[model samples]
Target chain A: MPKKEVLLEINHLKAYFPVKRKSMKEEKKVVKAVDDISLEIYRGETLGIVGESGSGKSTFGRTILKLVEPTEGEILYKGQQIQHLKGSNLQKYRNQMQMIFQDPFASLNPRMRIGAIIEEPMALQLTLTKEQRKKRVKELLQKVGLAEDAMHKYLHEFSGGQRQRIGIARALAINPEFIIADEPVSALDVSVQSQVLNLLMDLQDEFQLTYLFISHDLSVVKHISDRVAVLYLGRIVEIGTKKELYANPLHPYTQALLSAIPVVNFDEPKQAIPLQGELPSPMNPPVGCVFHTRCPFVMGKCHQVRPTMQEMNEHQRVACFLYDK
Target chain B: MEPINTQQVLLEVSNLKIQFQLKNGKQAKVVDDVSFSIHKGETVALVGESGSGKSITSLAIMRLLPIPPGEITAGTIHFNGNNLLDYKNKEMSHIRGNDISMVFQEPMTSLDPVFTIGNQLMESIRRHRKVSKKEAREKAIHLLQEVGIANADKMIAEYPHQLSGGMRQRVMIAIAMANNPQLLIADEPTTALDVTVQAQILNLMMKMKKEHRSAILFITHDMSVVAETADRVMVMYAGQIVEEAPVRELFLNPQHPYTTALLKTMPSLDTDVERLPSIPGIVPPAYALPDGCRFAPRCQFAMEQCQTLQPEVLTVNEAHKVRCHLFSGKEERAYAEEGSLT
Candidate 1:
């Protein structure tokens, strides 16, 4: 198979939020939401980001879409550095990289009609007449399995599944090359979640779209992602293909996270690695390794020195001293 | 393991029908003619999506629904050989938290923000059991430690906000187990926690239930939780019990189309599939339901009779029961004979 070109790349990305001190004598603190991460999103492949809450998966997606400003790092779009771009350049970057938020209800405008909600992106991204935008909105609605008459409905009129479809239509309205979907189907019910997931997959194939799918559910992540990244407090602890990650997980954190998932089959047994404690607060993460406090196989070095991502094999990478050569 | 007594029924609901009064002065049946029994020391899971009336059924058992908008229109809830519906509020209050306890989904909000963990746990102990303040405090610490809290002494003094989500849920479980109730109603107890934390909570619940020998009514949407904890599984849809069977048999051979569809839609970690087979339509609204089966619109094997006539519950086997026409009488017998031949 021919190599796929990298569509987006990140170099040493860091996003931190500084917290105010309670008093003058208290020291300032910072929440390392996304701390020093680097990876590449290849063209036409879905790269999934999985983690628990506060693992910085959503923040990382936001940083890539320029929704959240990076404290430090270089984000390149098709080999061009675009993080610090302003004005028209920034708008152009936003046009290429769209985001689908987790909550369908809050993400959509309550007062706006469905047609206007979808067409708003097109109006901002491209200079099109009202008639042209309406025409595209109707076509997009049909593509997402909704009837053309749905163009006149309000956000409140549709159910959770239908509202999610509308959210997808808005994301595709800009004709984005990269979509950072952050927990897109988490808000819907199980029966409805699959419908939305299938729709997203079909759209990805139809539009030839590359997706950075972010979710906390590993099973959902496994179904949609070609390559998967496991995040800890604020860092990518492991990255590999779905087969490599599922069949042979290198990182202990990844193993524990995957094993903890509740499989539907009764006889398909699983070995759950019960971590010692809860996830530490991002504001005061451990010095050596962020996961060492909860990691079962913690070595002395893990408490004194941080581990960096190292290549374990051809397609798998891990950030643990156990794999250090 | 000793076999549970099939004759000893802990909780039995007969033809439970719940109605909700809408704002426009109209009423709709939210839980329609649902009936099931929980055996002593058995873990039965109530599984369904949102608006399926699973939560409402659990709430009905607890008598927690708001009376203005919600009412138990018809049916009787018999718990421990007594009709809970027949009991007055005073008697009901005495039985609640003493014989039956519930653990809600969101532990963050379920706990009292102002009270310390010790204060909350002790309150339940003192309220249910006739124990002194000092004894209750000691029992509180013991319960906390029993639920796997390492620093039970200092942790009991901490407020709910200071504890993590997992710790808060453990505290909730500890409080629920303080009086050693015969029945524990856990309504999506571990849904909000992370996966690792969820595993811990589930393990802790199972261990606690085993030690106390409490029959648990585990309510959740995830089938994996059911597989891990429940002995019998009950699938609910549109305010009705669509299928009921032993956990292994239900997972291996689902009789209802809705149950099969639900199992198929869940993405498995063991297998790699391009796309999940999804049920097309959503659950019908309570106000506007189909004349026949609630899932007929989304059922792949739905027939003309399914859309027009309601099907009675048919016995698939000695333990398995289904409310679908396809599994009724001769068809089910033919399928069974075919299985025997195979």
Candidate 2:
């Protein structure tokens, strides 16, 4: 077997946003949105990032894209450091990377026509003629399974599913090699969600595009991802190939999260390990292991010392005291 | 239909028709001829996507639909043998919190942002029971504790915005279960919540129902939640129930094309499939519904007759019913004869 090409590499990336002080006497604080995360994305594989809300999954994605400036660490695309790239250099990186937002209605401009919305990205990045851009827009519309007439209409006229298709069209406008879809199908209906997921998979094969799909829905992530990462309070708890991680999740948080999902299949016996309390405030996260407060099988060491990601096998890695030995 | 024990029935809605007035003086029938009954302490899930009229049906039951723009055109909503449609506004208000309470999807918007959590909980309690403010406040703290909020006393003083989404939803549930209403109507209550939090809330709701012996009208678009919580399920599409069955039977052998398609389309955690078998086309708009079966346009087994004639509900068994042309008496006979010939 040949070695797979690494499309992107992130190293100890940290993104923090300072919180406003309530009063003069109050101490300064910051939200540790993405804290010391490192990962690799293969050339043509979907890497799913799953976490609860406020777990900083979205922040991690944004930090990698440089949409939100990282406070520390490196973001390397195609083995080149691009985190500090600015202006035209960053603009050039934008052509190779694009993001699809969660809410289609909010992401697409309400005032602009559908054709213009798809063409806007290309116009900013590429030196294509207006006529060529318009032709490409039509082709993209057809590619996403939308009719040509959709290009003439506004955002509000289309259904949620159609609008999401339009969002995908716009993301592919500049022929980006990588796309970060942040909960792209969460807003869509069940039937339509499958359609979009299928389209994404088809497009990946067609263009050899790598995806960083971030979502709270575990089932969706499991369906489309080649590898999966479980995040807890802005830190990765577990990361491995989809089959290895899902079938034999080493992290306690991952086990709880996998069990928490209310599976539609009734034949399987359910043993849900209920996590105690809500996610602790990101502003003031828990001491030591971020998950120690809620982990069902937490040991004393889990409360005093933070666990680093350790390899369980060739493919699976977990950040937990249970796997430390 | 199976023999339904009238004594055990908590809420019965029959041939319910709801319409919304459009700007062009036309009325759009949002909910068309919907009917179902919930037994005491049994959860009946009304499952559908947006514009499928699941929310509208629940809202109509609460008598919460706006008067001018939205109105119930026909049908009777019988709560414990009482027709809620005929009740006066004052009488309906009395029944709302006292007997049938609703939990909305958006907990933040449903709760009063300006008021403290204790203030809102006590208001619901005081509205139904003739309790003093002091007693109500104590009960509010107790209710908060019951919903799994650890620091009830501290939480009571906090504003809605101060609480997390999960905490706010728990507070909402506490308020809903304040009066121990005989029936609880939850409209996608956990849709906005995270899966872990959703599991917690769902557990709380189930526990509350068991303790109070209240029937739940659980409405959501998620099939997994329905499989988890519902005792019986009703799959709605384009404002009509396309299938109704016991929870186990619905999952095991769904007869309706829509239900079958929905179950297949949903990405399952237990199994791996190359590509999901998705249903083609979008749900038809309510104002311009097709003449024949509503799902015909998207149905894989749709016949020529299905395009022109609507199909009535066909009972597959004592606990299962499906509304599809493939199950109609004529089509059944035709298929039976063809099978014999083959």
Candidate 2 regions exceeding 4 Å error are A265-268, B1-7, B333-342
lDDT of 2 by residue, A1-325 (tens): 3689999999999999999998979998999999999999998999999999999999999998789999999999999999999998998887898899999899889999999999999898668999999999999999999999889999999999999999999999999999999999999999999999999999999998999999999999999999999998899999999999999988999999999989875776698899888899899998899999898988999888989999899999999888666
Taking all chains together, the TM-score of candidate 1 against the true structure is 0.97
Q: Model 1, stretches more than 4 Å misplaced? A: B1-7, B333-342
The lDDT per prediction is 0.90, 0.92
Index of the highest-lDDT prediction: 2
Please give the distance, in angstroms, between residue A111's alpha carbon in candidate 2 and its true position after superposition. 0.4
Q: What share of the true interface contacts does each candidate keep?
A: 0.77, 0.85
| Per-candidate total of colliding backbone pairs | 0, 0
TM-score for chain A in each prediction:
0.98, 0.98
Q: In candidate 2, what are the lDDT values of residues B240-262, reduced to their tens digit?
A: 99999999999987777789889
List the DockQ of the predictions in order: 0.78, 0.83
